[model samples]
Target: MKSSILTRPFYYLWTTQTTANAADVLYIMALTVLVLNRTDSLVSAALMPLMRSGAQMLSGLIAPLLMNRFKLPALLLLSQTGQCILFLCLALYLQLNDNNSSLVLVFTLVFIMSFLDGWTVPARNALVPRLVAHEQGLLKANGLISVSDQVVQFAGWGLSGLIVAFLGPGHTLLLTVILYGLAAVFTLGVKEPPDVESVRRHTAEDNSAAPSSKWHTLTEGWKMIWQMSRLRLLTFMDIIDMLGGSVWVGAFTLAFVQVALGKGEEWWGFINGAYFAGTVGGGLLVLTLARAIGNRYLAAMLIGMAGYGILTALYAINTRPIIALILVLLMGPFAELSIVNRRTLIQRSVAKETLPKVLSAQASLLNLVFCISLLVMASLAEWFGIVNLYLLAAGLTLLALGVGLIGRRTFHNAADPGAGD
Candidate 1:
């Protein structure tokens, strides 16, 4: 049965976000194949994720101030509309002479598209609390969205590959624009609270905090992070792990087909689809584990994530395509656990008034790490090869294990309502 709290806007947001995320994967894939075909340069190869990270960093830098006045829904809508325009331009370029074929142009388009996309995500994340009506509602709401996101990706990627296979990149880019337009329309179903509370909060936060000058507002999240040690630590750990994960993202499907198992591009789609499918199962287990054991979330996160790390390492070097695919599918069992615990920890630790800014800061920081990681990983992989990438990642995973030991206990006690008090 549908709860009234899970209203029409909620579903619309979920579906539209699904469409948005799916389109992003497709766009990346399209750009990847196009670049590979045009230049075959590994530096160019790394440009896609680097561009995304750069875009995200730019947004992350200014989000605290920008979000200070603009409510979440408006920010999200603006982002969606902005992406549509960026894609429309790219589509037109493709329809014109030689698709420009300039790596600079390609890099710029990805940066623009991704930059616009980053604006909305923090807003959407900030708005989650408003959508849900209670404490338990928080976990349930997050869990449902996680599950939906994974499910959407599982199917969306397969469909994206088919669209690319038959229609070609030009048509795929155009279709992405169309999907963004649809997302924009659906976004209209969302009603943002008029900028009252947001404005007041910003004023109060600024005035109460201290005298500040130039970009101080922009980097306020750093202040918040310093003040909140546990959060700072958690965000730092995420950055390190996310750096390792950058190669994981940049090369996963591509590696699965080309290097790991020697399957073709089409089989690569199957590999990603299976892994995302596992994430759906993973998200469900996250909810189950949280409910079954309240503060024991850390143990689940450690075991699940350590297991996921092992599986990813195996997938990196394994020769058997079937074995690799099966291992990846089973990866959800742990990935979900780690993610749910992370979110829960953040939610419990951060104040409601500052949640949006805090989230933005953390997201931006991780993404910055992601960009550097992508650059390093691509260079190293090109030089040292893919097998070594896994060995390096395994070492980072062990580092995360140490983090789990020290930080796990922190999150359990960090959520005291009176801590900041």
Candidate 2:
């Protein structure tokens, strides 16, 4: 028989994530349109993502406390259920108020819903190793998840416009509520292994022997990252890569298309579409090569980072629109290789009980870094020009590659699951 990881429970998890992700895209699109219509301000529309990110960052910071109290599946269920209920309220409010809906109340609901949703990723990741019977299963599992996410991203944006166009923002939000409800239902099927639960229980007991303060619970993940050598290096490289990666955000990418490629919004759509296509392809590639990559996770990550950096540099200088599209499409697989392997490494680098807290900390740091990068890169683009801005991003990626190179031995040792621990 095949492993349980490939069975019903994992499928439930996958379906829950897929539906929830779809709901996320739909709600964001609907909200942005609603805000734009109501406030007639681009700045107000933009504030949606900013507010979501801020709330999620705050959520990640405090997630450890909840992780300690609830099991991973339970935490996931809570998040999905909470989002569903909040979205229902939002939908009802929109329906009742019609033209007079308050943006303040809308944004407040968005923030709280986002805060509840923040636990999903960390909890899901921590559950993966528990769900899998073999260590190598992680590569295939992560690849599967990545592929689904990329597919959702590729199709979601395109479809959401039509959805909102037909149903209007209010009705579209009602659709989103349905998706969230489906996700919560599927989340109920995810179950942890008995052995894993026992280990977590023992770990909790050990920790409870000491009087754990709130401050310590909050900082536990941060402290783990600081103390673990491999984790520290991986996180540093992740920070640099994230800083560099911010160039691909919608506004910056649009700016690049206009300034460097001399193209318009149509090309912007093509570019985004191509990048997601590439990521889907990359995810498939990782799935095909899961066994081989699992044996040399560190090497694959380094190569991926290096290739992405090189492609980014070439992309920055090229003036041809066709070539720019190709470069970004090619950048996808390399980006996925690095991202999936690094995530797998992080999962394997710590004990089962500690993984959620560590991941929460890392997620918090990356979210904070990404927000800052957006601002810093926007300023650099303003000061140095669009072409030079991408070049700077490429330089940051190479710097990340350098960090990985410096810690090669440590990463090599960590290639085996649980080796670093």
Task: Compare the candidates by lDDT and give the number of the best one.
Answer: 2
Candidate that would win on TM-score: 2
Instruction: State the lDDT of candidate 1 residue by residue for 252-305, as single tens digits.
Output: 458647876777876776677778889998888766655564555456657766
Q: Compute the lDDT of residue 291 as modeled in candidate 1.
A: 56
Model 2 residue runs over 4 Å out of place are 1-5, 203-213, 413-417
lDDT of each: 0.72, 0.87
Model 1 global lDDT (CA atoms, 0 to 1) = 0.72
TM values, all candidates: 0.86, 0.95
> For model 2, how does the per-residue alpha-carbon lDDT over 1-421 read when each residue is reduced to its tens digit?
6556465778788999999999999999999999988889976887787788778888999999888767888889999888989999999999999899888999999999989987788888888777776787888998999999999999999999999999999899999989999999999899988887787777666557765566787798999899888889999999988987778878889999999999999999999999999999999999999977655778888888899889999999999999989998999999899899888888888888788999999888888898788778878888889999999999999999998888777755645346632
User: How much does candidate 2 score in TM-score?
Assistant: 0.95
